[model samples]
Target: MSYVDGFLLPVPKKNLAAYKKMAAKAGKIWREHGALDYRECAGDDLKTAFGLPYPKLMKLKKGEVPVFSWIMFKSRKHRDTVNAKVMKDPRIQAMCPDPKQMPFDVKRMCYGGFKTLVKA
Candidate 1:
């Protein structure tokens, strides 16, 4: 079974472009380091009557929108190996020397690792 790392966060509308650029660079690094897949997607239609909407769950501000992302690996061990290299990558360091300077709020970001239960 494959392993995956998921990310969800609220990004200010004004910084969406910058966030996209940063994500693109980060995605490239992950792929180079052997991640099976890397994807970043912004919220399109968040309003809904069923379940907790992302805007509410994330406590999105007036101009903020949710961004969902994931990185796939062959397995948990593979993910660990690739992530270690990505963390040491110079490009990643250059991209965010200080977590405080990230385009979005790191404190508000949600992240988790999951084992694939089903894939078809």
Candidate 2:
């Protein structure tokens, strides 16, 4: 079975474009580094319980937007190995000018290792 690393975060509405750009760059780098899939999705067609909005769960303040994304790997072990290499890849490091300016809050980011149940 495949493994999926899922992420849900709140992106500042004002920084959405900048964030998308950064995500696109990272997605390409991740794919090149052996990710099976790298996907970034903005807030659209989202539905939550009447009292359980996504941003509210993230403790987002006023004016933020939700961005749900994930990266897929062949398996959990593969995910671990590829992530380690991606972190150390020189090409990826070269593109990171300021780690402090990352589009989303690292502390607020949520991720989980999931086992895929079905696939077409």
Candidate 3:
């Protein structure tokens, strides 16, 4: 099984492009630091008939949408190692010198590390 770090957040529609640009750079940094895979996806069809929809779950405001992202690694230990290097990376520091400057609210972002339970 592999390890994964997942993230879910709300980003303003007007900031989506900026968010995508930032994510692309960040993904490259993660991959360069040994992440097996990295992906960032924006929500498209959020309206649903059943269960809690992302817009509701995230309490999305006008012109805001949910974004989901994840990074894969060989294992939890590997994830930790790669992330440590990524944190120390100068590019990352320059990209996000102040969390408050991010396109979305960092405080509203949800993140968790998971152990893969099943794979086909």
Candidate 4:
């Protein structure tokens, strides 16, 4: 079974373009480094439900929304290897060229690595 890594964060409206550019580069890097798939989805359709662990209601600014992304790998070992390379890649390093350009709050970001429990 494949392994999946998930991430969720809030992105500033003014930084959406910058975030997209960085995400594109990151997706490519993940693929090249051995990820089966790398996908980023702007959080538009998220809805609240009882007892959900994720934020039921995102506290958005005047024009901001949450963002979510995931990367699929053949297994945990493959994910580890790919992540290592991606982290070391110059392209990934350049994504955050300046502190002010970072789109999301790194401290508030949520991430987890999961083992596939069921698949179609």
lDDT of each: 0.96, 0.84, 0.96, 0.83
> Could you tell me which 10 consecutive residues in candidate 3 have the lowest summed lDDT?
54-63
Between candidates 1 and 4, the one scoring higher on TM-score is 1
Per-residue lDDT of 20-94 in model 1, one digit per residue for the tens?
999999999999999999999999988898999999999999999899999999999999999999999999999
lDDT digits (tens) for residues 37-108 of candidate 2: 999998764466577777667778687788889999999999999999888988778666676677777678
TM-score quality measure for candidate 4: 0.85
Ten-residue stretch with the least lDDT total in model 4: 50-59
Prediction 4 global C-alpha lDDT? 0.83
Q: Tens digits of per-residue lDDT for model 3 on 2-112?
A: 999999999999999999999999999999999999999999987799999998998888999899999999999999999999999999999998988999999999999
Residue 41, model 2: Cα distance from true site in angstroms: 0.9
Q: Cα-based RMSD of the predictions, in order?
A: 0.7, 2.1, 0.6, 2.3
Q: List the residue pairs that clash in candidate 1.
A: none
Clashing pairs in 2: none
- Those runs of model 1 whose alpha carbons end farther than 4 Å from true positions after fitting are none
Clashing pairs in 3: none
Residue 40 miss distance in model 1 (angstroms): 0.4
lDDT of 3 at 60: 85
